[model samples]
Structures are given as structure tokens and as C-alpha cells.
Target: MSTMDKGTGATMRQTAKARRRQAILDHAKRLFAASGFRAVSIEEIGAGAGISGPAVYRHFGSKEDILAELLVGISEYLHAGGAEIAGIGGGSEGAGGSEDAGASVGVGESAGVGAEAREGDPAGVLRRLVDFHLAFALGEPELIRIQDRDLSALPAEARSSLRRLQRQYVSLWVAALRRHAPGLSEEAATVTIHAVFGMVNSTPYVVRRIDTAVVAERLRTAALATLGVADVVAYRK
Candidate 1:
């Protein structure tokens, strides 16, 4: 093969390998989300991924490594996704980004909301964030479950990395919120951002009593109000 052809073939091989690796991770997510991380076994993950147990180790050294990759990968994914939502160097078009974010977090699309906020549309930016994260909370409740209950189970380095990514994600919200409410201080905005996350993250528990549309609307409004947008009507739509 020509040198460039060889390079292309090698790249294809790597891509194929990564796809197989992700298949394993996808199955592990379902198993981990359905059963607690501790309850899930390597052999089971292998079976779910249609691979032998020994083959699983070729992709991941151990079960903990898979879990760590899952948690850390999602954290990194969320941070990157939030960066795009907040317009941090994310240019106007962001469709491919939408898919990557949704896939990494084990959620589907965010209703085609990859568009950057309109010029002079600060509320638009905030709305984008609210809409995006609400979709995540609703669609990936299992991942959320792992985040809330099993975070401490991760190895120390992974746990720390996860926390760091989470904090960066919150900063994206804080930056966007400041545009809507200039009076918001760093500390106040941080608190508001954290509280809003807690509010939306409650979706899994409350989905039974109310329609998701209603839940999403209430959260968007409440989050805007929390950011001190007194007239949230303009933004809630």
C-alpha cells in the first residue's frame, strides 16, 4: 500500500478499535446503571458487550478501570459539553458537538439546541444551558444515579478528576449566568449554579408525579429566578 493508504488503513483500524471499546462501555453503563457498580461483574460486562471476559481486559485492565473510565469520561464529556453550551470558544455551528455530548452522557439529542446564543441574547445562552442540562437529567438518570450515590467508589484520582470536571462545568454556568444578571458575584453565582444542578438532578425522582414538560418548564423558570432574573417570563419560553 502507498504510505498515505497505509496511514489511512491504520487510522481506520484505530477507529474500529475505539468503536468496539465504546460498545463495551455502553453495555457497562446499562449494567452499572441498572445494578449498582459493585453488583456488576467483569464477566457480565463482557457478555453484555459480546466479548470474552479475557478480551474485556484487553480494552480495560480491570473492572475498576472500566468504572473509572465511565465516570471520568462522562465528567470530561460534561465539562466539554458545558463549555460549548456556554459559548466558550464554541463558534456558531455546533451540531456534531451536540451528538458527541449526548452520546458521551448516554442521553439523546438536546432537541437540536446546538446553536450558539443569538447575538446580544444572554437569556438565550442561559436558556440553552437549562434546556441542554434538563435533557441530560431526564435522559441519563442512571448516570445521574451513579454520580449521586457511587461517586465515592471511584479511585481517588478518578474521583478528584470527576470533581474537577464538575466544578469546571459549573463555572460554565456561572459565566453564562453573569451575563443575565450582572449583579451576581462569583460566590453567589456559584451557589446558584450548584443549587440549580440539584434541582434539575431531582428529575428522576419527580418524573412520576408530573409531566416532564412541566418539570422542565418549572426548572427553567426556577433556575432563572435563582439567578436573580426578576422577570423570568422573557427567558422561560
Candidate 2:
């Protein structure tokens, strides 16, 4: 066979291998999300993907590796999304901008402000942080569940790294709260942010077992309530 033919064949083989790897990961994610990490098996993942059990091993060394990939994927997503929201300009249209400057504002009200103003308005920045988190959790329920359930299965170092990434995400929100409500101590804001996160992250599991509309309404209500609480707390003290 010609050298060119051999090279083309090799490229095709590589492409096919990558596709298979992705397929395995996708199927594994679905299974892990549907059933906690402990309940899912390599064989089940492979069967769902129309591949043999050993084929999964070829792509990921073990179930833990698959879980690692899923968590890493989520971490990357949150990092990128947070950066994007932080980069928005004050004049930008859509969800990231101010409707009017003269309106009454809460201590942490600036948390929801656009990326451009994130540096200037703590409350706006905090608002944006919450929005970014809720957007991700509400949009990717399966990924969230998988991450929450399988996080402990990851190695210590990997777990630490994931925890660091999560903390960094939360820091952005805390900073905004500090700015908007200068009276509140750092410890207070930290606890409040954690509480708000719990409310936001719980929506996925709730949605799975109930009607979609009900889930949607609950998510909205929860978000608004959290924001309202943040606003009240920021200004109250």
C-alpha cells in the first residue's frame, strides 16, 4: 500500500478511537448520574454504550477514572463560565447589565452586576456569582449529581484540587457580598454563601423525582429567595 494510504488509515483509526472514548464517557456519566457512583459498574456502562466490558477499560482504567473525568469536566465548565461572566462590560446588554443606576440597592446587591462592574460593585459582583452558579446547576443537573455523589471516590490530591476550584468559585461571590454589605464580617458572608449554594445545588435531585415544571418553579423560587436573603442580610446589619 502507498505511504499516503497508510497515513490516511492511521488518521481514521485515531478519529474512531477518540469517538469511542467519548461515547464511553457519555454513557458512564448518564449511569453515574442516574445511580450513585457505588451502584454503577463497568459492565453496565459498557452495555449501555453498546461496547464490551473490557472496552471501557481500554478508554478509562477504571470506574474511578471515569468519575474523575466527569468532575474535571464540571470544574472546567464552572471556571470558564465564571470567567466569562466576570468579563462582561457595564454597558453590555442582556442579563449582565444595570437597568438603572438610581434604584435602591442592597448591601450585596452588586453581586449580580455585570463583569465590567464586578470590580467596582461588590453587590453586583456577588449577584453575578450566584447567577453563574445557579445557571450551571440548573442547566446540567446530571453532571451536578454525578459530581456530588462521586467526588469522594476521587484520590486525595484530585479531591483537593476540585475543592480548591470550588472554593475559588465561591470566593468571587464572597467578595461581592463583602463589598455590598461592608458591615457584615467575612465569616458571616462565607456561611451565607454556603447556605445559598446548598439551596441551588439541591434543585437537580428534586427536579429528577418531580414534574419538570414544578422543578423549574422551585428553582426560580429558591434563587429569588436566596438573593432576597442575601440582600436583606447585607443591608440589615
Candidate 3:
């Protein structure tokens, strides 16, 4: 065979291998999301992927490793997306200013507080928080479900690393909240941030029961309302 032909054959073989690996991960993610980590096995995943039992081991060491990859992969995906959004000038022009206007309105109706609390524009931060969660949650529901449900199955050391990544993700939200709601204590902001996450992430499971178009609209409205941005924009006058 010609050298060029051999090179093309090698490339095709590698592509096929990569596709098989992805197929396994995709099926495993579905199983994990439906049945949780403890109940799913590598053999089941391989069977679903139409691969032999031993072939699964060639792609991943074990089920825990697959779960780790899924969780960490999703975290990394969101982190990268957030960085991209942050770089794109807060997702769009005028978005930051509009967010600030909303925060101002929120402060006007609240109880009296010191100047330190007023330094950060809480409304703008809340808008970014909503945007971030909506982007992340909507992009990867299967991965999110695996991360939330299968995390406890990871080994101690692996769990520690995963926890750090999870904390970093949380810190991004907390920091945004701190900037927007300067008067709010960190503890208070943390709780609100988690609440926002709960509302955003739960949409996937809930929306699946409805039509896709309706689900998208509901998600957009719910995210904006939950983050208090809707009120801010409405009260801008």
C-alpha cells in the first residue's frame, strides 16, 4: 500500500475509536441520569453502546472514573463558558448598565443600610448570575444530573478535587452576587445563589414534560424573574 494510503487508514481508525468512546460516554450518561451511579454498571453501559464488556475498560478504568469524567467535564465546560461570557463584555452591550439600574431599584425599597452595602451594584450581579446559570444548566442537563446525583460515589481523594472545582464554580456566582448586592452579607448571598441555582437547574427536568418551544420560553422568563432582573428592567423608569 502507498504511504499516503496507510496514513489515511490510520486516521480513519483513530476517528472510529474516538467515536466509540463518545458513544459509551453518551449512553452511560443517560443511564446514570435515569438510574443514578450505584445502580448502573460498566457492562450495562457497554451493552448499550454495543461494545463488549472488556471494551468498556479500554475507554475507562471503572464506573467511578466515568462519573468523575462526566462531573469534571461538565464543570470545565461551564467554567469555560463563563469565561467566554465574561470576555464577551458581559454577554452584550448595555446589559451591565441595565443590570445596575435594576440593583439601584432593589436597594431603594429595602431597609436602610450603611454606604458599604451600597458600593456594589447588586442588580447587575444578579443578572449575570441568572445568565450564567441559564447558560450552564440549559447546555448540559445530563451532565448536571450525573454530577449532582453521583458525586457521593467518588473516592475520598477524587471527591476532594471535585469539591474544589464545585467550590470554584460557586465562588464565581457568590462574587457576582457580592458585587451586585453589596449590602447583603456573604451568608445571605450564598443562600440566594443556591436558590437561584435550584430554580434554574430544575427547569430541565420540569420542562421536559412540555413542548420544546414552550419550555424555552418558560426557562427564559423564569430565569429572569428569579434573578430579579425582570423587575429591574420593568421599573427602570
Candidate 4:
């Protein structure tokens, strides 16, 4: 066979492999979210992904491996994305190369925050952070369900890594909140941040009942209000 032919074949094979791997992850995420992780098996996941049960092992070591990728992957995405919007390096240098998690890849800007947001500006950081989070909360509620219900199912190392990334992500918001509302004690800010997370992450429960755009606006408003930021208005889509 010609070298060009071989190269094209190799590229096609890799593309197919990549698609299959993503299919497994997507199906596994849905199954794990719909039924708790422990109750779902590799066979079930493979079936959902349109492959035979044993074919899954070619892509992942075990069910827990897939779970780790889903959980840890999103965590990494969130951390890296937040780090970018906040205009700083990630919280820690680690085995994965950076801190992070997430689904949608862009930062949304609220009308109140304006379009000329510069990096390192506190209000700009906070506005982008809020929109960044809202995008995830609304776009990937299933991951939230898996996180809430199945985190303990992860291997110890994976669990620790996920938690570490989460803490780092939260710290980004805490810093922004305190920077804007300097009157808030650290404890108060921490508590409020968790509250906002709980409120936004509750999308899994309530998202189906409302228009997603409306939900995004309300959540943005409530989050900013809870954090007591008066300068940024709730962004309307």
C-alpha cells in the first residue's frame, strides 16, 4: 500500500477509536446518572454505548476507570476554565498537568458586566466566573447527579483528586466574592459560596420545569444577590 493510503487509514482508525471511547463515556454518564453507579455494570454500559460488554475493556480498565474519567475529567475542565476566566494560574501543579472541570467551554458575559472585561479585574473575574458556572450547571446536570450520588464509588485516589479540584474551583469563587464584598468574613463567604453551589447544582431537580435561558438568568441573579454584588445585573439572554 502507498504511504499516503496507510496514513489515511491510520487516521480513520484513530478517529473511530476516539468516537467509540466518547460514546462509552456519554452512555456511561447517562446510565450512572439515571441509576446510581453501583447498580450499573460494564455490560449495561457497553450495551448503552452500542458495543458488546467486553469491548469496553479495550477502552477503559474498569467501570471505576470510566467513572473516574467522567468525574475527574469534568473537575479538571472546571478548574482550568475557571482559572482562565479568573486570569490566574490554577491552584496547584499536579499529575494531570493543571487544576480543573466542565461541559460548555465558553464564558458568558452579563449585560451588567459589559463586554470589555479585562483579565485580572475583580468584577470581570467574578462576572465571568458566575456565567462560567451557570453554563455548566445548566448544560450538564447529569454530571451533577453522578457527582452527588456516586462520588464515594470512586477509587480513593480518584476521589481525593476530584475533591482537591473541587476545593480549588470553590476557592476561585471565594476569592472573587471576598474581593468584591470585603465586609464578608472568610467563613461567611465560604458558607455563601457553598450555598450558591447547592442552589445552582440543584438544576438536576428543577431544570426540566423551566426554560433554560430563564433559569440561567434567575440563577445568575440569585447567585449575585446571595454574594451581595450590586454592580453586576442579572444577564438576560
Best by TM-score: 4
Candidate 1 regions with alpha-carbon error over 4 angstroms: 1-16, 90-105, 108-118, 205-211, 228-237
Candidate 1 lDDT, tens digit per residue, 106-130?
6664334335544667777777777
Clashes in candidate 4: how many? 10
lDDT by residue for model 3 (8-89), tens: 9999999888778777877887899899989887789999989987899998888887776666555544443343333222
**Global Cα lDDT for candidate 2:** 0.64
Estimate TM-scores for all models: 0.77, 0.71, 0.73, 0.86
Give the best candidate by lDDT. 4
- Model 4 bad stretches (over 4 Å): 91-120, 231-237
By summed lDDT, the worst window of 10 consecutive residues in model 4 runs over: 103-112
lDDT of 1 at 105: 44
Clashing pairs in 3: 121-180, 122-180, 122-181
- lDDT by residue for model 2 (57-128), tens: 888888887777667556644544454455432321222322221011101122232644535755455555
Q: Evaluate residue 119 in candidate 2 and report its C-alpha lDDT on the 0 to 100 scale.
A: 57
Which TM-score value belongs to model 2? 0.71
Give all candidates' CA lDDT scores: 0.73, 0.64, 0.62, 0.76
lDDT of 2 at 54: 86
